[model samples]
Target: MSSKRVVFDFDIAFTNGGGIQGQDFRLDIDGDTITDKELADYIVNDMQLLMVRKVDIINKHYITEAHKRKPVNLKADEKLVDLSHTIFDGLVTYKGLPAPIICDYLSREQSKVNYEEGTEFQIGKITMVTNTGTYIDCPFHRFEHGKDLSEVALEQFADLDAVTINAKDAIEIGKEYFVGKELRNKAVLVFTNWAKHWNTELYFENHPYLTGEAAQYLKECQVKLVGIDSHNIDDTRGKSRPVHTTLLGAEILITEHLCNLDKLPENGYKFNAVPPKFKGAGTFPVRAYASLG
Candidate 1:
């Protein structure tokens, strides 16, 4: 198959300044063979640019040399720890919520007819509630008219200065744990070690959780996000979810069922728990992790 060609212009910008300045550039891509979105992603990934804000097509003819850029290398001492549980077929994340029904929407064997020899693909699908696995909660999770998952800003969920408060063996975490700590614009993760019982019958029982006063204190400190490695941020046995109500009411994001907190230091790391941009959804699972510099 021959590759189609197209010329385009783009305005690139970096999240941090002093990088490359925004400029219009032309490029030739296989417009007939590749989708517009794939071509745009190629420009960003190949150029090593932070974000592609705009793309305008100029022409759809003539081929040119594909621009190449080197990929960023990780530092020698940098560490990344996964803090989320893997979602598997028929695996229970929460007690009452139905387990995710993982299956192939399009089987690999069936796709052989659509592609050339030896080419196959599998398209999988999952059906589950938003609260399954390690999930994040926005204001809409608690309040009727509040910021949903799509409404929350990316900065609120990613690349935030993080600190973990180890409260192992404590069932109720109180405000005293964070009395004098600096928490403004930071991801405050509470390490309770309760995640050790994950995927077991004991995980749904009485587990460690943050108290109402602790949530209130975090709200007062303007914390960007709050997370805990436990069943729920609030005591699930009771009807009043004060911890969720207090924090979400103040627009503070929350992440639950996180693991691997023991691998992270008390400070000097960045935390991220970003979910998909699903409009009208208040809660969703995230691939929570921490980057240690």
Candidate 2:
């Protein structure tokens, strides 16, 4: 419904030094009116410009046009939806675990000496636990003798039929939710909308989780994978984690901290959440997504 767009010129000065300018840029606004503050924030965030000190919006005007950047053309049989959170520096996935320390090992400016004129590259380094972002658990996570990341078959985590169980406003999801659903060999993603509280203190307190019975039911159904859009798949209150034990013990993969499940339909889709094949590792982050027709 937002057909309004703004065409404007802007100059942004960085806090450190140097500045950049743009002209004749068209941005779709949420409504017919937009202030300079919102436009400046949008430009800085949309461009991912670091160290922005000030933004000057100039020659601004509105126009009625379709948003160019939002529309895409895809075949009727192909549509992909992202279901993972972006991992960034200082993002706390869990309370006790240290946030990821991401920094550039070889920066673009430093690479100039080794390259021909004007050729630059950046090599980044990340130091964090495997369970930093939206991650999957292998059987090895709970059992020492179970398969590790490198040993699990690709069919276990990639391109599998999937379903979404809606547990809106429910704190403890039970087995009743899955009694009539076709869950066998399907990646069942539970939508509790808990991701809306991510990056906040509330996200870690009394979050939605699957009860032990739910885990047993999914295991009995021989589900390929179980994903949740919450702080965790199982309750984090006590020292016990029956859900993880029940599911991963049966070789059913578990993907936690998944987002965007509300955008998916009930069924008739393929889910993919493949982690890097790391030897001796039990868990690692994944770029989870759903392919729908």
Candidate of highest TM-score: 2
Model 2: lDDT of residue 136: 96
Candidate 1 lDDT by residue in tens digits, 114-164: 999888999998999998899999999889899999999999999999999
List per-prediction Cα lDDT, in the order shown. Answer: 0.83, 0.91
After the best TM-score superposition of candidate 2, give how far the Cα of residue 159 lies from its true spot, in angstroms.
0.4
TM per model? 0.74, 0.75
Model 2 CA deviation exceeding 4 Å by range: 1-78
In model 1, what are the clashing residue pairs, if there are any? none
User: Would you give me the overall lDDT of model 1?
Assistant: 0.83
Give the residue spans of candidate 1 off by over 4 A. 1-78
Give each model's clash number.
0, 0
- The most accurate candidate by lDDT is 2
Evaluate model 1: give its TM-score. Answer: 0.74
Expressed as tens digits, the lDDT of each residue in 73-170 for candidate 2 is 12222489999899999999999999999999999999999999888899999999989889999999999999999999988889999999999878
**Candidate 1, position 27, lDDT:** 48
